[model samples]
Target: MRIGLYPGTFDPVTLGHLDIIHRATVLVDRLVIGVAINRDKGPLFSLEERVTMIETECARISEETACEIVVHPFENLLIDCARDVGAGMIIRGLRAVADFEYEFQMVGMNRRLDASIETVFLMAEAQHQAIASKLVKEIARLGGNVAKFVTPEVRKALQARFGADC
Candidate 1:
């Protein structure tokens, strides 16, 4: 089966992420959402929480698309994680030119590590292009409405985390 891996530190899975996940189902029989355990980023949510959020959000996508979706948490290299999940492609969501610059370098490095695995970039929808988890968290922390960026469930999680009625 064609398996694809999409790796990210989904501190709180945003609508932007769901957009990518929904689109990615068309490209692979199985889509593995790799929740990275990057301690350096000091994510707002724990790995377990991130995985749970992804699983919950993706369940509908999986059912609608008939593509098996799995949430796999990884603390190792992304390329290695791809191999672990038997992914022949690594899916990435691009928001802007700034994101491309960083992703370009990552693609080069990942190619050097394993030329067999290819990386595919999916541009975010215009509406979701501006939504980022970091910015979403900041907006929530400051008591701004984040209903536009995240699902109602995730919005509640952020509200609980920040103890604000955002």
Candidate 2:
């Protein structure tokens, strides 16, 4: 079976992420959503919360696409995480040229680590291209509507975190 790893902090899975996840199903029989435990980033959601969010959001995608989706939390290197999940490809979502610059360096470093595992970049849909978890959180924290960037459930979660009015 072709397995792919899509790694991210996923502090709060955004619509852009869902877009990539949904599209990635077509390329792999199993898509592993690697929720990175990056303490340095100080994510808004805990590891368990992030995993639950991803699992909940991806359940429908998996059912619709007939592709198995798994959420795995890891604090190790992304390349190591890919190997652990038996992923032959690492899927990444690109939003803009700025994202490409960083991803390009990552791909080079990852290739040096394991040339066998390839990286695939999927550009975000135009509508979702501007949606980012960080910006979404900021907007929520500042009492702005985030319904456009996240699902109803995630929006609810953010509201709970920032208060009902926010």
Candidate 3:
């Protein structure tokens, strides 16, 4: 069976990221959504909260579908996480040239570490190319209504974290 790994620091999964998840569902038997524990950036949502948001969102992705979602809060490194799960492919979403530059370097490193694994990049939808977890936090922090940009669970989690007034 072909298993695909979609790893990211989904502080709160955005619609854009969800799009990739949906696309990934069609390409593999199972899709592992690895939430990287980004200690350097300091995530706004705790690992538990991120996992909850992902679990709540991923659960609603239609059980009848061919693929299933596995939410994992991964720290340390991505290649290790992928190796642990036996994923031969790393699925990524490309929003722009900048994203490509970074993902490309990481892809090369992953290939060097394990030549058996490879990275796949899918272009983000035109409308959601600019949406990101950082962008979601900035808009929410500034009191912007981001209901349309993310799932309801994510919005609720953000409201809980930043307060309803925010």
lDDT of each: 0.96, 0.95, 0.84
Ten-residue stretch with the least lDDT total in model 2: 157-166
Is candidate 2 or 3 superior in TM-score? 2
lDDT per residue (tens digit) for residues 96-160 in model 2: 99999999999999999999999999999999999999999999999999999999999999999
**What value does the lDDT take at residue 39 in candidate 1?**
95
| Candidate 1 per-residue lDDT over residues 1-166, each given as its tens digit | 9999999999789999999999999999999999999999999998888888899999999999999999999999999999999999999999999999999999999999999999999999999999999999999999999999999999999999999999
Q: Model 1 — TM-score against the truth?
A: 0.99
Error of 3 at 1 (Å): 0.9
Ten residues in sequence with the least summed lDDT for candidate 3: 59-68
Superposed by TM-score, candidate 2 places the C-alpha of residue 125 at a distance from the truth, in angstroms, of 0.4
- Deviating ranges (above 4 Å) for candidate 1: none
Backbone collisions counted per model? 0, 0, 0
How displaced is residue 38 in candidate 1, in Å? 0.5
What is the full ranking by lDDT, best candidate first? 1, 2, 3
lDDT of 3 by residue, 47-158 (tens): 8878888777777673757577898778857888989887888899999998988888898888888889888889999989989889889899888898878877788778
After the best TM-score superposition of candidate 2, give how far the Cα of residue 119 lies from its true spot, in angstroms. Answer: 0.2
